[model samples]
Target: MSRVLVTGAASGLGEALAAAFEARGDEVLRTDVSYEGGVETGASAPSSTHGTFRLDITSDDDWAAALAHVEATWGGLDVLVNNAGVAGGGRLDVATMDEWQWITEINLFGAVRGTRTFVPMLKRQRSGRIVNTASLAGLVHPAGMASYNASKAAVVALTETTGHELAAYGVTAHVVCPSYFRTNLTSSMRGADTELAGVVSHLVESSPISAADIAAAVLEGLDRGDELIVPDQPARDAHGLKQSDRATYDLVMRAQAAKLEGAPRG
Candidate 1:
């Protein structure tokens, strides 16, 4: 069985992916900033094949420690899933500098650090996979989430570049662009203002996909060796919108915004 390490394993997609891997008899190491909480609750009922490690993705020292633990236990990692992220909800005009920095630190820089620190381990394996969780917001920018969109878009670019660089080493990279998966990521999102909060709440309510579905899609993508994994129907459509026509895509997004604003609230 393959050995895997997943970041942001406290909840949502990361937790789901870790559970899936463990269920398949793979050795899974789950990590998150929520050390006590995640260990006590996140993997409360995890399979026998799974273990937990407290990791702060933004810290190099934490990554080093986690890698050392993997070396001691699993010997080598076959998969590295950078699933940690923070959502920043706000309009471009009013977004704070601190919010922008914080979002990028976790969402973009965190992935970069994971990829960098784990590549040596993966290179030793010769045949390994790296999955970075991006989002549909990366492809089709929504009106009020500029910082989040930018960070995810950077993840897409980073994944593409890293995939090319690691190709010669027999390591593959995949970027998951999921649309509106049901998870705590939304509830924990930082809002710029009250107006942005309302807009974000509406978006979350309208999302049709779930974290479990996205996790399943990730495994399928890994099996297929897909470079970019758009997990759901909405994600597929959003990707198509990017490639079809720029003007048409903008018009469609504008229409969506209008409809969201007009829709009744409970």
Candidate 2:
């Protein structure tokens, strides 16, 4: 039985991950920013768990307090799932700086802060795992998701560096880059174009993959010790394209604008 801490566990993929771990007899510390209304964060299943704690990923104080709680309650963590993320989409030229900062702070820097806080504990234990939730947009740059893409790509890089730095200490780090899946991320996204947001929302809503599917894939990755995990076939394909052929990938992504009406003609 492992001690795990999963961020953004109120709902969606995070919730599913927490459930999955609990099912496997792991003690999970489930935390999320939205603890009050939209979704209940504290629900437990068949196994033991720490009731949801209010964790705003953007706050350093929150990270400190969370670590304190983990140290006090569970002593040390075996796995840290930095799964909290917010999506943003709009043309690079028109997207607001606030949107960029918001996405970066929540999606990219959140993982960084979590890693910085927990690496010491993991190193002390001499065995741990960090799973960062990135997106296919990070590996495969999309035309309208520059802010989101850049943030996730940085996470990918961070995870890679972490894998190298922590391997000797018996701590493993991995990045989960998934494509469109049904989740609340679409509803909460911040961006300039409502229509474009809707388009992405539609894609997620219509997608066959569910949050549960992603959670399962993530668990599989952890078990397999994958350094970089692409959760679905679409994400795998996208990552492969980017790795094998950059020019074709860019052209294909840029050509996506042709399908979206009113997207700035480039």
Please report the candidate that would top lDDT against the real structure: 2
The true-versus-predicted C-alpha distance at residue 198 of model 2, in Å, is 1.4
Model 2 residue 56 CA deviation in Å: 0.8
Measured against the true structure, the TM-scores of the candidates, in listed sequence, are: 0.90, 0.92
Model 2 agreement with the true structure over 119-195: per-residue lDDT tens digits: 99999989999989998887887777778889999999999999999999999998998899999887678677676
Q: Give the TM-score of candidate 1.
A: 0.90
Taken over the whole model, the C-alpha lDDT of each candidate is 0.82, 0.85
- lDDT string, candidate 1, 106-201, tens digits: 999999999989899888778788999999887889776778999999999999999999998899899999887678886777745556666666
lDDT of 2 at 185: 85
Which segments of model 1 are wrong by more than 4 Å?
37-45, 255-266
